[model samples]
Target: MPTRPNYNQSSANHPIINTNNNNNLNQISIMNTNVDITSYVGKVLNINQHQVIVEDVLGQGGFAFVFLVRSSNQQRYALKRMYVNNERDLT
Candidate 1:
């Protein structure tokens, strides 16, 4: 059997309560630790004055890499990192 990376499971302590409102905040993100966030593992990313701890990598594409990040408030979000910045887009 392959060894698994140890991740903090504190996020699993909270109980999930789904409300009538359609919001992602009500969902629970039970990370499949089997898949690791290779490059960004154990790293905190600060972008646009916002800081988040990368938990698991959601997915990756040609131009950008999506990460499953957790905020200080215990909220989770899909942080999309756009790598291909063209001169026109930056301008």
Candidate 2:
């Protein structure tokens, strides 16, 4: 079995309510753990000053995971998370 990552939820103690209005603020979370694609659903990620909420996994490979995400402005985007085990892979 794969171990799930420990992600810090934006409002773990508070219940999130969607008002059907897109003006609501997006929740935030900090990710720091091994990638388990299934665990990323419903997680809000902060990237390049934008808040992207992960909806589902679109694809996956041995070293990466592609997600179908929605931005705070209700825009859909593909977010890819890649992993490199060694320094050589950076080149």
Candidate 3:
């Protein structure tokens, strides 16, 4: 009888798992704070080393929200935040 190859040691396992790990590495860095309507206004959000001052909510749909944000230099931008609680949401 022939033995089945051990998939655990397969070279193919590295890339897929590493890619998922890299993605999760960025994702798990996000704040896990319970963000609500009250928590947004007057709050400062830091993204990619840029400091964004949350001014007001631009819009919202489902679990995603777009807020009006301004940089320290007065540049304006729309910041979109998604609420994800588990693996299903991440997928």
The TM-score leader among the candidates is 2
The C-alpha TM-scores of every prediction are 0.53, 0.56, 0.54
Evaluated against the true structure, the overall lDDT of model 3 is 0.54
Please list the residue runs of candidate 3 whose C-alpha ends up more than 4 Å from where it truly belongs after superposition.
1-35, 85-91
Model 3, span 16-50: residue lDDT tens: 11123324335323465544554676787656556
lDDT of each: 0.50, 0.57, 0.54
- 1-91: candidate 1 lDDT, tens digit per residue: 9532334332323222222222332132223433434657557765544567777655565655555677778787766554423335533
Candidate 3: residue 6 Cα off by (Å): 59
Q: Model 3 reaches what TM-score against the true structure?
A: 0.54
Kindly give the number of clashing pairs for every candidate. 0, 0, 0
Ranking by lDDT: 2, 3, 1
How high is the lDDT of residue 73 in model 2? 73
Q: What's the best-to-worst order under TM-score?
A: 2, 3, 1
Candidate 1 lDDT at 87 equals 32
